[model samples]
Target: MKVGFDGKRATQNITGLGNYSRYLIRLLTKFHPHNQFLIYAITIPPPELAISEVEYRYPGKQLIKSYWRSFGIIKNLLRDNIDLFHGLSNEIPYSLKTAGIPTVVTIHDLIFIRYPQYYSFIDRLIYKYKYRYAALHADKVIAISKQTKQDLMHYFGVNEDKIEVIYQDCDVIFHQQVTSLMKDEIKKKYQLPEKYLLNVGTIEERKNLMLIAKALLRIDNIHLVVVGRETKYTLTVKQFIKQNQLSERVHFLHNVAHCDLPAIYQHAELLIYPSRFEGFGIPIVEALHSGIPVIAAKGSCLEEAGGPGSIYIDPDDDVELAKQVKGIIDNNETKMKMVRMGKQYLDNFKSKLISDQTIHLYQNVIDNAKR
Candidate 1:
């Protein structure tokens, strides 16, 4: 089978949606080697993400890249005789079904719809049109979490039967053990404190990094090491940190290499993710596999990511957040037990299981098309 993917993010992005596209493609090629995979992108994928087994396709001479991805790509899909096309992002070509090809789309979240305040008006309008169209038209909708599946149904009136809730796994590197020497090297390279909590995500308003800064005030001794892209909210948190004299207590590391992230996770005492919302919190999963206890926000899909063993507190309650951190720090046994349970919970997100499920969905869509 020749399977094609909308590969804009896989080639162009390094984090978030880009990571998802690249990981999914890598998983499929590694596990289902019998099937041919094609990545259709505006630009060729970076060397690090490029797979030898897969073919990369681009527009021959068309300069308008976004237009080609949305409309012109359908012609290439037909020309290549792609058995199925999957939109790794939130959209598919507008005319795929009309051209008689079965299609699938992965909807990461409806954050723009759920939190309009976080996005520009034009972005919200564009996202709603694309996402709603894909949900209503695609042969199958892959929702990364049940929360996202529910959001699709509620926000776009998508049929529940059309959606599949498949969880995502972090890079295999996180599963590998980082040696003490490597940990020490990373620690020295970053000037990391001996004892520090970790938070990994874009420091944006929706991510709610201020909650952690507020909690840090009450807790003593341990510092915070934040690893992610800085946003305007970062300045807000910095202002508060300066005002509260937390310049030494909080360390922000941006653009850390992907390979070094697991070591950072390993060295951390705990992972505190106080984001107001998420589709599926990949950092929580990374922490689980890295053998650290996690304290995440409530009222989102974070529980699904953190599992029953990890701790949770209100996103707004810095007092409770501090209390939970203190509890974990004071009790080594409790922290270890949470780590143990989190690892056990990871069985549901094993790479083989997720890969096989995705392949099966593709096969099912193909079989139905035949009938």
Candidate 2:
């Protein structure tokens, strides 16, 4: 089968959705080499990010790039005779149904709908239109978590049977054990504390980094290492840190290379993710695979991602969050138990299992279209 992908994020973004797209493409190709895969990207990715066997197709003469990705990619899909097209992100071309392409879209989350206060008015409108359209029109909708699946039905009125919940795995590099030497080198290079809690994700309102800051007030000597892109919300977090004089204990590392994240995870005491919501918590998955205990906010899909081994606290309760952190840190038995169970739970999200499930979905869509 000649499967095509919406590669805008894969080619342009280096984190989050981009990582998901790239990881899916690589997983599919590595496990099922018999099929051909093509990426329809608005721009060519850097050479280092290119996949081994997959071909990339870019718009030839379309000047309005975003327009091409939305409606103009139809001509190219027809010419390529794509058997299936997967939107690895939350949207697909608005014209794919007219083109009769069997389409699948992965809706990571309905965060904008759930937490409108976090997004601009324009962004919310655009997201609602595109995500609702894709969810309603695509042959299949892939929700990274069950929480996202219910959101699709609740917000978009999508049929339950048409949506499939498929969990995504992190980059395989997280599974590899970082050596003691590499850990020391990375620790020194990044000036990370000898012992620290790790928090990974963009510093935004929905991510709720301030909760971690508030919890820090209760913990005695524990330090936090935050690695993510900074937004205006970061200033809010920094303001709290300054007011509380927690600057000496909290470290923010921006522009940390993706290749170095595993060593960073390996050296941490645990990962604290106090996000208010997520479609699927990839960082929690990464922390689990990296063999670290995880503490995440309770009201969303994080429990599904963290599994039974990790601790979950209410996002608004910093006191409970601090207690859990102290519990895991003070007791080695508790820490090791969480780590062992996390690894066992991670078996359900192995690359081969997820790749196989996706392939089966693709085949089912194509077969139904033919009939």
Candidate closest to the true structure, highest TM-score? 1
Per-residue CA lDDT of model 1 for 328-366, tens digit only, reads 999999999999999999998999999999999999999
Q: Model-by-model lDDT, in order?
A: 0.94, 0.94
| RMSD list, candidates in order | 0.8, 0.9
Q: Residue 48 error for model 1, in Å?
A: 1.8
- Tell me the spans in candidate 2 whose CA falls farther than 4 Å from its real position: none
Distance from true position, residue 223, model 1, in Å? 0.5
Instruction: Kindly report which residue pairs in candidate 2 clash with one another.
Output: none
lDDT (Cα, tens digit) per residue for candidate 2, span 263-327: 99999999999999998999999999899999999999999999999999999999999999999
- What TM-score, to 2 decimals, does candidate 1 have? 0.99
Cα displacement (angstroms), candidate 1, residue 267, comes to 0.5
